[model samples]
Target: MTPQQRRALDFIEQYYADRRIAPSLKEIAAHLGTKSRTRAHEAVAALVRDGHLVKTHGGRRNIAPAQIQLDRFTTAALRAELQRRETAHG
Candidate 1:
């Protein structure tokens, strides 16, 4: 996946973790600071097409991550990296 796509997925994952719900296209655009909601839509479409995400419940906050992506950081890896950065910066 491209970097932009990865960023969008990460934002989705974080959003799900924090809110216990999927974010909307607007939310995704806002979080990713994309040019527009249309870009967010395209990113989401790419994710769903590539099996990184799934839209469920006939289109609600049911957007969910699929089986773990192979080319991206696992949850633990992300936590470790975050901790490493915090420790370095702190």
Candidate 2:
């Protein structure tokens, strides 16, 4: 990840940690000291592409970290991943 992408991801993770909700594009822009929500979105899109974040459709606060805590994997998440893999390979 680029330096700016890392910064955006850190801000996003911190925001979610504090509120248990993802930050909006506008909020992310302001935190990055920019007024352009599009720029903030691009940063977020990059993070999503790089697998540092995930975005679900049809919701205002749908973005989440692919892993809640990078260091520790949760059992439920592991099960979900295993199910997805099984479905995909079957």
lDDT of every predicted structure (CA atoms): 0.81, 0.83
Tens digits of lDDT, candidate 1, 13-87: 877665547798888898888659999988889999999998778656668888644345567766876899999
Model 1 segments beyond 4 Å from truth? 68-90
Model 2: residues >4 Å from true position, as ranges?
70-90
Instruction: Estimate the Cα RMSD of every predicted model relative to the unseen true structure.
Output: 9.4, 6.1
Clashing pairs in 1: none
Highest TM-score: which candidate? 2
Estimate, for each residue in 1-90, the C-alpha lDDT of model 2 and write its tens digit: 888788888888878766668999999999889999999989998999989999877678789987786434456756777899999999
Candidate 2: count of backbone clashes, pairs at least 3 residues apart or interchain: 0
Against the true structure, what is each candidate's TM-score?
0.68, 0.72
Q: Residue pairs in steric clash, candidate 2?
A: none
Candidate 1 at 72: error in angstroms?
14
